[model samples]
Target chain A: MLPVATGEFDLIRRYFTGLGGDGDGIDLAVGDDCALLSIPADRQLAVTTDTLVESVHFPANCDPALLARRALRVNLSDLAAMGARPLGFQLALTLPSVDVSWLAAFSLGLAQDASTFQCPLVGGDTTKGPLTLSITLMGTVERNHALRRDGAADGDYLYVTGTPGDAGGGLAIMTSGGERHNQYLLERYWLPTPRLAAGELLAGFASAAIDVSDGLVQDAGHLCHHSGLGCTLVWDQLPLSTPLVDEFGVEQATRWALSAGDDYELCFSVPPGRAAEMELAMAGAGEQVTRIGVMGRGISGVSCVSSDGQPFRLEQAGYAHF
Target chain B: MLPVATGEFDLIRRYFTGLGGDGDGIDLAVGDDCALLSIPADRQLAVTTDTLVESVHFPANCDPALLARRALRVNLSDLAAMGARPLGFQLALTLPSVDVSWLAAFSLGLAQDASTFQCPLVGGDTTKGPLTLSITLMGTVERNHALRRDGAADGDYLYVTGTPGDAGGGLAIMTSGGERHNQYLLERYWLPTPRLAAGELLAGFASAAIDVSDGLVQDAGHLCHHSGLGCTLVWDQLPLSTPLVDEFGVEQATRWALSAGDDYELCFSVPPGRAAEMELAMAGAGEQVTRIGVMGRGISGVSCVSSDGQPFRLEQAGYAHF
Candidate 1:
């Protein structure tokens, strides 16, 4: 699927080949049949893959650079959830046609994020097809230090980093073709930061962890199901960005926070006894986390309750790919 | 783009989750945020990515099992070209819709090949789109033993494993839909064997190596371009299958052998002094290799000559993606 077209190499060489510079743990980079990567012996490789379809995942026509950033960042969020430090990534990008300017912006965006996360673009594959991006990002984690869904225990404190569901709201705004007054929401939609530092900090400490991609409540279900526990999320404590709340109002924001996806924020659980200490550690590291729920065995599945012990329900579970 | 639709998990859990099995170098396999893998510190990872789009790479409708095999084998071919041992692979499949029986067959095909190659399914991302499969396969190779295009010397024997161009002939047969009588060519097209063992045997021996996927002439040009040498391909020395020769005749067979792609065979070069020794080594391994040409600095690019010393020419270079 490579030896990609005539100018495909030019596109990659001109825009992408320079992404992974010297001393990035890459023994050999592009132009070879395979990229030879040097992973530290003591560290285990953490591999996560994500594929974004043009019409299904994002707007058909948007900033290509932002799309590139979002694609890489969301995958980084997975590495973050596993408490793996960024290493390098392979991008298999399919396009319907070659657009030089679009590729320029896309590669630029990838370059920026690769630099920001210290994850260089080690290798890539390009083909002609409907615009699709499949990125396989690898990271390094200390042996047995990966935060997993099964690590959670009953009665652990569930914490979420940053606001959840703002990106979903941003998507809503973009889809409606509405006035783009809320730059914060748009940026959140375009750039959902991967909590890499927080993930590294929480590696051995957190009981269980996951990124809020397919909504907070649904992904929380995964943690609960895998851990054989149930969770109770307090509606009032849900972290909603001010812009999202102001634009979509509290009820919608509450639903978005609970049901809408594409947040990319970390939703992790820690032992209640260590909750205060973990919070302190995160704060010291310049990260913000809100304790919005508690893991328990009382509930069968995920439950949402308001201040008065009132039950809250979601219309749909989360984003689904069929 | 996971957290798939209602039946998506059912599809994955039923057909895919059981692929890697219990022990295959996967610390953590599917269903996790990231797959935890153990790569020996001394060995570098040989990573390659490939994407096959529907109607572009293969027929719109075909046996899902063969398609799956082709998808994985071509990528494995890249690993074999680098003389790397297969470790694991991640498949990102984007489909227009979920088909149950299709997935069952596809997963079965993948299971057979993954088990045969010793490359387990580490992780995967499934989404909805115009049927596209992007696979990122990783292998482990000794730090400095990887055979590269640039490793060739000015004077070396250009050797190829197995017969090339049969798969291209197979593709031609498939597209015309004239007759399916030639099962050999069809199998060659569907299952281009990845010469993994030969690659391992050639690791430190061969000066340069590349899998013949994008036509022998073009790929050989890559070897010449990178190694700063030209090549003289002896036309009469090329190995051709009896079935291919009978079906397409000698002229077409010669053209196909010279310029058609999708052969998945290894085209490698070794110093002339060691060519016989390397040939004996390959013979010991029960693999066949033919010295079809010689690499040299005599010409600026690739030149082909027949037995009578007449120069040969082609109508087209090879397949182009765009």
Candidate 2:
């Protein structure tokens, strides 16, 4: 296998040249000094980046393909926040050694996600180091219409797309003895479906938006805090996966749904009247849009109510970056 | 010292929160789910990223301040290739532990460059890992006016900015015996100056351009090879630093100037008619511009000629990424 440090040209040809080249908004792709992107006349570009490190953000021996997809997906989930369409992304990869099989699998995973998501690989750098991957994603949204977290207001309804807590349940199972490689849970933990369509559909309708990366409650707190508003969550309304309920029970599943990271679901707030419109949009996209809570004015924080309408609190707030 | 995974929020707040918030085209800054940037109405953004790892890219005990500066400067050099104006950058740092004092000094050096170059720190991710730093920079250029290596033509004059091989000289000094830590050489290796002003000046004037990160001869080879031309270098005209000449002698200094990397200077081609104009541009920017070679159609590689016009060739070409 060719090492990236041997020559950048060889590395580019081997891993990126043939992949992610056939996509829109990519004026110039990899193997160039810098990638050239053409933003559509009426669209604005949105960019987000995330870095995942071995034994820190993920396990050292984690599935290479799945890890690649997850890293890109997390950045895509950020695009979902701005209601942007994924255009392309650049990756910076650092590895301790030149392991061909691992690189093949990892590149396959990245290529698969890029194709599936219609995001081209534009440019990147590969270097020698402790295993690390940084992906910078670019997306497009209507000019001046990108979603912002400071748009939430009192009386807005909070909604989350898709089921949550499956990832948390998967983590529990993976860490324990049930199954080290349950396809469904592992897929949930690794290959997340970034709620792009739902976010695009919610662009003008949603008041404040954020992806459920850190967790439902934690991300909700972000929206509220950024918008300078408080939010009330109806725990009974949170969408929990069947596997989560079966494994952890409804109460524990709800708690997990509130605190688990890596969900990649969109948690957004819409005005009360637009709730029905959001449902219609979801129906058109063949996706679920579950209402979870309501936004309110006051000190910026999150409050949760159980099935019986009592206040609920969690021991862990969210995953924080230092 | 707090390990990054343990001091998440505080680290982000201290290192990233408001660092690049006041940049020219930044729509939104850090402390959000994702950064928002506005590509100027008449310009396109040039994006590039690079990652450095401890013990691989640099020694584990490398000076923190210098390491931080190079982490961003190298990426800026990529922007320089595209003839883009430095706007801002994002950093993703993964460290085993957070030494507050070290981070402070590192940030101080970063701020010095940021302030000097008018580029701001817009966003970044901080995590725990074996020490690694990835920087993604965004710059702006007038639509369709960016310099590219693909635009070079036969008979174009090749030019390079400033002295070459100081960084390589510093690296050699570090690896070789007998030479104590020379502050000048060491600083060159560590705190590289990105040729932003020079690049902007070359935007409309140069036929093709690239920044010398992988030595002049090798990188110029890229410009020539990509442009389907061969290049002839006048070796005696090659620029060198006083320290490099004093330390390595003329022949070795010439070799280092030809083949060493990490200079972060611009190398470009200009039509004969535009040579005087290009010189004025370089002069206006207060950067050294030296004519080193000429591009021609032939073997499609680089060759150096001595003052007497004899062929000059090295056993090896330049830095290979691998």
Candidate 3:
């Protein structure tokens, strides 16, 4: 049971209602049973849902605001992976108990990110329960133009954005000892940018794309699973963040780069001849990516090869929260 | 940590992925980053989110299939309140452990409702945590056709569909000693129908609308608050089901009807001039309603009037989760 202060706060009106935009596409906002939105008839709506539970998906005592930002960023990454532009979002948050300050900090972080992402909080629900945040992000894309996982063909080159696995490095440092204040790694972990521009750009060039959440290898395996093909990763070409490499060493960094989760970066495949044009388009967009593998036929799943072209084995794939 | 058996279940592919409609308006169904939906150009998308947590919202040992149906039906009630037609839904479930039989029953209930309501299951997430379920239901309505709470005017007649307090009596029976086996009361509590037809009909005639989740008085208060008016519910006119009255008597049933929560029936305001035509339309639609009150200006919040025209005092308004 929560303290009576929970009711005194009037969470919907006091906190959640004022976070979104000034009624751009929203015909109605919070306080109602349903929020109505007009998505220009030319575009199709893209929706995704992601949930984070305390002590399961995240540290139990993480900063509330940072947790809020991280939760939203991860869900937004889903839309980014789909090449969908921001529309709005609905949050269904379950809490064990209500602490005014904790709620204040949490809402502040949500408001901040909601503004940054240009996605308003169209509606939401708050209930007393174990602490968990589930966000169903809604976005829009041109009709029939969404980047899908099954579109990539054999021989398509696999590409990844930013240096992957810095988030896992951050997690390792945070859990290992008193190095939780490592700014770069922690920022990467909690606030990995949702590559909206890159996703929208790639929608036209990349045959298929997905954001790196469940580690590079496992997530690529998802693409292979969906596309009915296999992929080979050039072990030496996997991008390793400089900070991660410098702190954890190349061996540890490579392991994190390939096998750790929470990387919020895009992984896509470019058709052979379209690579040059896609790269050229991406150069000026401030989104850097490295070609790490190529999709091929007649294989079971994702395989990796060292620079010498010898098969490399990854001891474990990635995290699964079941 | 959850049992390694959770990983063994592959909850999404096995249970959730196959619950939705047969690829209608769904470009990509379960595995993708976002569920792409092609909402017709002439329609506006109406969205709502609802969550239920174990121990707080329900008994710890409620039947899995019934719980799943109740959860989804309650959320669908919101869509009905808005006069929206069902499109699809997303479920984010947090489970303490993976039970194969429980998952099977829960998904069966969800699939049943998905077919019954014509709302497909578009996507979902399953995670390890204290048991909780969050659903975001999406639907569509013609532009400017949504039945909303802000449209009622002073002097409008307040009407409610079906009997309002049966669910409350059902809950009372369940929580008191050993009346849980009372089929009529328990069924009313667990399987309250969403007044979709009534809502769609009301959209064309009612001034304002909301579904009864927080009891009659409080939900009517919501309509008043949003419409910038006050409403008076005639206690004598409050609809009480025969089963509830049979067990609890008239006085007790009146209290439950006016104050207890979890009635999925719709409470709406109809303009004075449209009552006859509205009632005629409702008659042919096979939906029955009772006019219980009237909206007025200058009075704050919800007031109750006895049969003799004196103010009737209600001990409590409704349930509030904090």
Candidate 4:
């Protein structure tokens, strides 16, 4: 059973007001007609918006706290891909009914993540509807230094941070009930960490970057399409979690890495001559940078090849909401 | 019947990309991980988000084009209240299924408003869900010059721009079907003009301001609550439409003006000495500015009284979404 909401204003005051401190870049927070934000003079604002619907983005009975975190994290991932430092976000949450306990847990999770990422809740609207969460995150990047998808060159080397297929494997586990007790996998599905630090470090070194939300290959194809180039992803070089490899064989793991979605890891391209320097920089920052593929001058798509130079046929490219 | 959407990406490319131009303070538009925005050095960003859900926010079968316009206009009204100049907006649209005709009409209405307000479409997300539209609008105001609700003084005279309760009367007409042929009231409900020019003019003169969204009396109460003051509104002073007076009678029209919501006009307070100056300023700007009441140093709430100084009783203060 869900707790009843007392009223809209009361709910917002109780659950959202203290989500984060107002001092960072927000001149004014909630309770006003609009929030006043002061962006640093040297930085440009990076803005993105995303929406998640119940039963479509997650299971119907999923934990509210995790749902809130996922909703904010996915949007933060977009900022990370653009090499922007998270500043704050506004939430538009629609609920089927006022559920006090559900809201309490959800707000607690949101507050925790807001604190963790230093992205405060600035302003938002709460309305009655089918359960849905929409977040618009704002960040700042140095003028002309923000990473873009159309900057990849013909000889750019593709690199990815973190394992690509773990979230998909986690989703598969949750859906199939094959490993119901796999907490790691469940955590991967519910709590994706945006690669903010890695992206920031790669800002000057990377030619093009994108966060892997719609599977590695499909998103790589997006990068290629924007850059007017193609890519050759080495199947053996694809990163996979130990648990994913243990549960699913090499072939399945590779397939998930290429075709499954919701990774939330940064995949970027570096100029061929700067690959070694970029790797050193990432290593110095204590982040993993994996060499995954290379951009080529060809049709805009990703071609997968095995270690022995054999072509691998993928069943599907990635997940599409439509 | 609704038309079918070709695909998500294709639909966005066809209908939404051309919604606004790229040069108006937008460094990067759509097709990127995040849109980049450049705020003037002397200005602070004013951000606000609002969500509209089908059946809850509007009639279930409301026209898609009208729905889109209402969604954007309501958010723009918030900017007006803040005395901010419109810059750009991000949209998160969720639909139950692909509806090509609906999307085309919706995007057309959205584009028209974006162009009219000079608030371009910066970024957005589209997902599959029950029909919902969430828009986060961004604007700019000179630092420390934003009109706030907490700035009213004890001796401030209260004022409003345009007639209040017209939209409520419009809504009443739509609900009862008594005057389906009343195009004026129907247009009032479907399309509200935000008092941008008036709000901008009020920035330096008005002590505090707010958009009359939750009825004139209730929203005035909000101003009082923020300013730690009280207000006494002259019941007969409220501006009412001629049609509203003719259809609902003077008594009910007075009640609607006092308690019915969705006016979307600016309600503000001016220091006692600035009333004439404000009137002159507004006259110069060719906008209506009506003096309706006065702020007082007392318990916080709106007190309504008739022309004879007798207290007026209201059954409900305002509309509450919950």
Candidate 5:
């Protein structure tokens, strides 16, 4: 529910005036014409923006609270890639009509996330239009410590965090799957946990890192192509939850793992010898880091292999925005 | 017009990629999940964002090129309030339907203005939805040199640049007013000239500043209230072009100046001692700077007055967003 007949400035002040998340490096927060932030003396600021529209990015009847969460989390995923710590963010909202109740829930959800993440809401604008959200997130990383897509080296182990396919499975449930399956899967798709902690930890250990928004296979291909390397993926070794296998057959789960989207997981690559140390660090942080593949010198594409070394195939390809 | 069924990534690359305007501070441009910018060692970054919705901010059938200009210009105006110089910007565009030709025209207009202002496109997002555009602009200034709304002092002269009522008149012509009377007004309203140069110059001399968006009197009230000062505006000296007066008569023009909105001009205050030097600087730059009022020690409010210091009543107030 949004506020009807509420002016732009009042709406902003009532819902977004203060989250008080700024510290150390943030110089100024909201209230002025523009917010000001500072990069630590030896660091650069990582920034990314994303827009989500009703019926395009999510179902038309999507929950307002979840929509806000997903919108912010998607931008946070980009920050995760750069090994940047969340500092602050700006929001631009467009709505078809005002519904005060909806807005209250949305703002409450946004406020909770901002508090939990410690990223202040620095600036934003709201207008009347089809429900749309655009968020720009800012983060910081030490100079030269930011991860690059083209930095993966040959013989590096490709790793991923958490289970894959939960989000895709969730989507499937949404379209008429069982009550049990739908609830679990819907939660995965609607409320993804961004891998900020894992990403920051991997900054020094991983050669390159990317967040998996598209399917794992497609995203891995991006890393490989950018890094000028080929990858061999171990299908049997993929990390999957028991529920995923029980809800869908093993083959279906594997296919979803390969081609499903919206996992918000981190996929990265590190040298072979550093894998053990990285694993220990991830464990210490309670992160579920899984080694799924290895970067190779000669090939330029990803090859998914079965336990017997046979090539794996899927009927559906990864998601494409087109 | 926007592209038809354009894939999301391709649309972003086509419209927003490679803009790296004013690259001296850009650490990374588009293509990665997020962008990285290196804040200058001695300057602080000023950031603001704005969103414009079709049939809300502008008429539903407004020109694509003009709409694009307005979207960016409005955000730039916010930067001007802080006396920040243009740096780079990001855009988020959403459309109800794809019209390739419209996209081409809109992008061309945006690129032209971006280049003209020396502010390049740094990053943005595009998605399918009702027509809406969001822009976040970043600029820089010497540390603590930012002009804010809280610094106006008693006895300061309240000044404005260019004329105030043209755009308001144009808006009247656009909605229900006669075409002959509205032609010039509409043009001014649709294609506002941002007070970039004036703002940069005034940054050094002005005590405080804000852009006139909600009409002269309303915006003046904002400056006064924010700075905890009172303003007495000389209605007789309110700037009006001869053409406007001839077309709508002085009374109507005065009404428009008082309450009409959409004029992207600068309204600022300066100490009395700097008035002469400020006028000289503006004249040397071939710009129009009008001294229309004065700041004084009184309750924070705006009042219209005659040359003889008699209070005057206005027929209309500025546009109210609510």
Candidate 6:
């Protein structure tokens, strides 16, 4: 039998109180019934919520620390897509039993991301049940500058930040256990960074944006459906990391790039003439921005063309939760 | 086997999109990567989150509609304790399978409460998992006026809005399978109302405030611990409804009032001379304010005395989550 641990209140006090320390915007913090935050006068609050359940979102026995980072990062990626600056977040964590080491590592990873992104942990709830995590993150964006999915024009160039297929390739590598210690792919899978800086820079320039969570094609379909436009992707120009290409070859890597999900990179559209200006703005942001497609007036969906100008087809678009 | 329903996104669009219909402060509603809220310039945002799990927070097979109301109300009670007015909320709901009838009933209760409390549903996430409901509520309070748990003075009078222990008695009746259809007790358990009006009125008058979630005595001990003071409760003065007394004898009802949990009322402290003003403020609010104790400088916990001036002790202070 497992040893009994301290109750919920004590566990929270011992582990979670000192996180995201008393920042200027927080009028009240943990230990209170509700946290009070002073939103800056000129900014509107952007809120998003995401929940990860065991075995559904992640594998059954994934590392606790890495799970913590991925959970928070996915929510942060939503803010990035909306062109919002991080403010703070609240966590609701449910567990089947108390495990001190797991809690310690999880909180450490959460604290690291919170500090790095400047999003403090304002308040949270911990309960007993099957392991599940729910995070509601709040951010700030200028009143009319929030990037929407319906703003793309008929002839805009579609661009994505960072390499698109590395995380998906990494997930495959981790699951197959062929090369268990491939540092690049494993790290990409475990610790994908949200493109906060590029998102902020894209606020005034990009016409539309979305994070690629459910494959490039499915998410592009989302953009087209909302904007009432059709999208065409040039298959050869799809960004692929050298490691992924080396491991899986060009054809397989392209498939992963187009059809695999959980990449967490931002895909947005800019007016064709402003591509150079957007490129110059992102030059010093340390992320490579790739123009992979173009939007057009027609039916509202995504189509792919290979280097030889032939249409490409795949088995499925992306993941769907039912 | 159960029949397959629509996917997660379709389910949300079908049932939840029309809830809490586009309110004044919401700049962006459901269909976006993030919901945008425009906070008033002079108001601070008050935030709180809570999660309820199946078979832990409530019995198995409980009514979905009632569970929805209870989940949202408990979070609203936290905002009420901070003297904040409702702004909006985001929900993260998890379920074992797609049950159309269950989803319809749950969303109905949620929509009803969202309308009544003036807290609209701004954003949410739905996923497939074991039954769980998590809500994060946001509200607004004036700067420097939000109540805290550390503001009580040594001589402040401790008061609780509404009769306590009814929910506990209701829970007892529910679990015992006797008098299960008693509307008053069952409704008290299923739809505990947050003291929003009283809390808003107590903003400037109450010294320290907390919502009585974990029984009266245990929650009072929380106030005393935070305020660096001690409290003494007059056992006979505990406000017990006639129905609760009739169902359970006086001694058992008193025990429930002291140690049973899940009472969503406001327990607060007011200065000695402001009782009359506080009473006048709460007179027409549809709930009685009962003064059951006083604060003093001593050990930080709560003690009770019988009407005959003898010490009264119970087996435990309140419910513990472990």
The number of the candidate with the highest DockQ is 1
DockQ of each: 0.55, 0.44, 0.52, 0.50, 0.42, 0.51
TM-score of each: 0.97, 0.94, 0.97, 0.97, 0.92, 0.96
Q: Give the range where candidate 3 chain B is weakest over 10 consecutive residues by summed lDDT.
A: B1-10
Q: Record all residue pairs in model 1 with backbone atoms less than 3 Å apart, i.e. clashing.
A: none
- Expressed as tens digits, the lDDT of each residue in A206-278 for candidate 2 is 9889988777888888788779888888888898888778767998888778888888898989999888977
Global lDDT of model 1: 0.87
**Cα lDDT of model 3 by residue, A1-322, tens digit:** 0011227227667878778565467778787989998888778889999999999988887899999999899999999998989888999988878787898899899999989889889997888888899999999998888988888899999999999979989898888878545789988988989999999999889999999988888888888878989988887888888898888888888888888889989999999999999998999888898999899996668887877887756677877665
Q: Write the per-residue lDDT of candidate 3 for residues B1-322, one digit (tens) a residue.
A: 0011227236678988768566467667777999988887778899999999999989997898999999989998999999988888889998888888999999999888888888888887888889899999999888888999999998999999999888898898888989445688788889889888888888899888999987888888888878998877889888778888888899889888887889899999998999999999999999989999889996677878877787766666778675
Pitting candidate 3 against candidate 4, the one with the higher DockQ is: 3
Candidate 4 chain A: worst 10 consecutive residues by lDDT? A1-10
Name the weakest run of 10 consecutive residues (lDDT summed) in model 4 chain B: B1-10
Per-residue lDDT for B1-322 in model 2, tens only? 0011225666777876666338776777776656777776678778888888888788877778778878888888899889888878878888788788888888887887777777888777887788888888888888998888889888889999989888888898888775566768877888788888888888878999998888888888888767988888889999888988887788888887888888888889999999998898779779899999898987447878876888766766787655
Write candidate 4's Cα lDDT for B291-318 as tens digits. Answer: 9998999734788887688777777888
i-RMSD values for every candidate model: 4.6, 5.7, 5.7, 7.1, 6.8, 6.4
Q: Which structure is stronger by DockQ: 2 or 6?
A: 6
Clashes of 1: 0
Between prediction 3 and prediction 5, the one with superior DockQ is: 3
Considering summed lDDT, which 10 consecutive residues are worst modelled in model 6 chain A?
A: A1-10
lDDT of 5 by residue, B47-110 (tens): 8998888777887877888888877788788888888888788788787766778887888888
| Consecutive 10-residue window with the lowest summed lDDT within model 3 chain A | A1-10
lDDT of 4 by residue, A1-322 (tens): 1111236778898889958665577898898899999999999999999899998888898899999999889999999999999999999999988899999999999998998999999999999999999999999999999999999999799999988788887888888866455677678878998999998988989999999888888888888888998988888998888988887778888888887788899999999899999899889988888998899997447878876888777767788779
Query: Which candidate, 2 or 6, has the higher lDDT?
Result: 6
**What share of the reference contacts is kept in model 2?**
0.47
